[model samples]
Target: MQKIGFSGTLDPITNGHMWVIGEARSIAEEVVVFLSENSTKAPKFSAEERKAIVLASCAERGWNNVAVQIVKSEYTARVAKRNGVGYLIRGIRSTADFDYENLIQQTNVEVIGGAKTLFVMPPRDLGSVSSSFVKALEGPVGWNWTMKKFVPAPAYKAWILAWLRKEWDSLWRERPHSAEWFERLTGEQAYGGAERHYHNLDHLVHGLAEIRAWAANTGAAPAHVALVKAAFWFHDAVYAHAAGEVSNEEASARLWLGSGLEPDAVRAEEVATLIRATDHFQGGAMLHPLKDTMLSVDLAILGQEAEVYQAYATGIRAEYAHVPEADYNSKRAQILAHLRGKAEAGTLFADPFFTDNYTAAAIANMSAELALIAGR
Candidate 1:
């Protein structure tokens, strides 16, 4: 059976809300609704009241297959991860909503690592219905004016009353959390408007994949694994490609601390260190105790040990396909030279499995990739 989860404050249920839930039900055998608690910046509704309204609204439609409750704490992603719910559900009504929702989904994937997102578009008729509009006395007229046009009267009344008391606005209009904040502040340009040579969705996926490979090969200590994974996310997070001075270690550490991940400050710092160690020009003399795994990851790419490296290159080429070939060639050359030096010096990666074999594999792979790129 599929276990699906729903999040958000239901200050008032709107036709749009119901439509998403219906879509979720069609895909999974069970739908679990977790009401969001209003933070200082969110709307002002108690968890219990929101739960009641959600249950009442679901009952009106005989949605017995769904289990409704409040999601505790501000860490909704953590809560959902603990529950073993793989998919986080949301409904999109317009292009604006899609942009915001996309960031939330991206952040969850970053923090949780394994979760996926499912976006269900609102039913055609209820496309414009939203909790914010329902709550605004002037935004949209009587609930039935739209409800009868899209939703049942009872459900519509339940939705409006929930919002009338100002409960739903708690989660709405709040400052976005981590990933959301990143997307809002950033644009298509990576650094100095150089068009971002690296650090894209593909980079993130590659980091996670390398971490996964390391975890599988050596079963590294769990704490170390978590730290490494988190580092994979924060590293290169502050990319200013044009300046060529981004600190995967320093900036990522600050990001972790700023995001309230201070409890693991030391570990976060270590990961940042590892990220910096991945710098092609950086040598092993400055390596730290965590250097082995970090280097292993860096070499995993520098050495082109697997198809992952090629994939990374392919993504970069595609992203900058518009750039002048001369510019691409110059940047690509510097990157390859950096990789070659690291591999040649036996410092590109730290091999945890045997201290030699893993490094050897990486060097061999990277050599072939470098040669291929040069010939091209």
Candidate 2:
């Protein structure tokens, strides 16, 4: 257990890989990660880039006992022998993994003679995570939160920043914007404000994911999906810090209106209308499927699991912490009660998609939260 080896291409390291590393770290004095370079492998990230990322991830977690060795065209056992590492850590998440890894372990110890393979499995929640899975979440809908859970902190940071750049580049592909506009939109003045604990870029990413999921379910055309996505981008971009006269939604919509994402002013207006639906207090119903879809998606967090709901509520409370507690509690109670009432009336979600998935859970979360506020 003095020295141990963990080997993989690790095109990019993931949380699950970190789990196994933690296991090796627990027993070993030093854990050396063998970042293998196979001639035939076409990895997403180069070896040097992956090594820096892995080292940064270790730094992020304050894991000082870990080290890395770039293995070029060498066998794992030979590397282990060269490094004087007696044990190699292998992850087994399933019966198939066990069957495969067990064979390898036997071969390494009995047949190969240089290293003994120690098998470890992550907790069931992390059982399925792999680099391939993490890589696949890059451009997809509904993956920012999911990807955050799977990737290490440093890699996640790199990933989200990269994703933001790619997203904006795609947004402005047809209609180009200055570097300053991109910064203004994605940086602190907009969604990335210091005051924003929630409603930030990640939230926008989640909303985009949800809408695309909605599109896939409803078989929405590319145009409609694009319109809804535009609405999502500008919906919370001007959150809370309104310029005195206009509401946040109006401010955000005005930005969209000026931007030529959609040449048609009418469609731009539709995006605006959809953005306006995010204002929970404005009781007027927009009453179109697309609008309702936007509304449902905007509030979709309400219908998520208790943990996600709690996180959402906590973020909302954090954002409104400047308000006097009594006033904040009172105002929040009213909104929660209104939602509770809506839930009881089976009108909590406008889209049947969300209505079916989130209705009961949303009601339950609101009711529990309301009880806490009342008691407080």
Candidate 3:
């Protein structure tokens, strides 16, 4: 099977790139889109986000033979050769594009003796669409119905969420003592730790974003919002990598109480209670609204799309690398089965926001994972 390489920043993949990928598919048995980063040029999205967008786009289009990857090196020819790609594909929309790509093609040929570069010109309708053009339309007011035509649905959704996250981060930066302080402290504990993979800074950020959105829409009280945010930060602060050794939730809550981040004894106790609610092992009714919200947010990963959920599962396995596979799968299945039961009962989340939007998907994802583990 012949493998073809397509390299670009793909900041936000456009219809033009899809057209070129289709053309590459016709010529090569397998196609890999390399989400390359250039030091001289600033990217609108991170490399990981770009790769996810590409993968999601491919999944939506049913492009089974196309794979998306992040390229660490700027040397295109060497990357292609290392990936077993025999040909490199580039799209040319005009004379300028042709002129620019021709120079790179010549250099690539010299770098990899036997590799080839193929130029594809998109159809007239898509020729004008580019990443730069899509990026220009990115803003709170610019992403309208018309802008949707140029980008794939999955990519557009990912880009919008990423943009929203950036805005939220900026807003928190302005108030460094509150949201930003928790962000920095939790970020260090989660991302800098050696045993973290799934329950890391990114996971906390996602949880915070979800809670913020829900709080905004529901007109939640400022105090309630603050409490939930604190829970999100400390829920997994002391992630226990091994199974059944100690309760991470308890340790995290104790750490939060002693840190003096929240000196008020009453609110500090509330935050600790919310963090313990995330321990799905102790199944029971939530004692308060804040605890309910925190529990739902912690289980939100169950409702993500299949690809994203699969990645979450993979990260979790990586975190428990010390555990034997059979034992790990057994423990994981038990937890998922418990969640699945709650999901099926329509009581997974006390909040209407999560119950209405995520209940069905969460149940389905948990069932799927349980089956996979059983089969293995």
**Model 2: lDDT to the true structure:** 0.81
Sequence-dependent TM-score of model 1: 0.42
The lDDT, on a scale of 0 to 1, for candidate 1 is: 0.60
Report clashes for each candidate as comma-separated counts. 6, 1, 0
Off by over 4 Å in 3: 1-188, 192-194, 242-246, 280-286
lDDT of 3 at 299: 75
lDDT of 2 by residue, 327-366 (tens): 9899999999998788778887878888887899999999
Error of 1 at 32 (Å): 28
lDDT of 3 by residue, 261-362 (tens): 666789888888888887756425437657778877887777876766777788899988888999999999998998889888999877888898789878
The order of the candidates by lDDT, greatest first, is: 2, 3, 1
> Against the true structure, what is every candidate's RMSD?
18.8, 4.2, 10.6
Model 3 poorest ten-residue lDDT run: 138-147
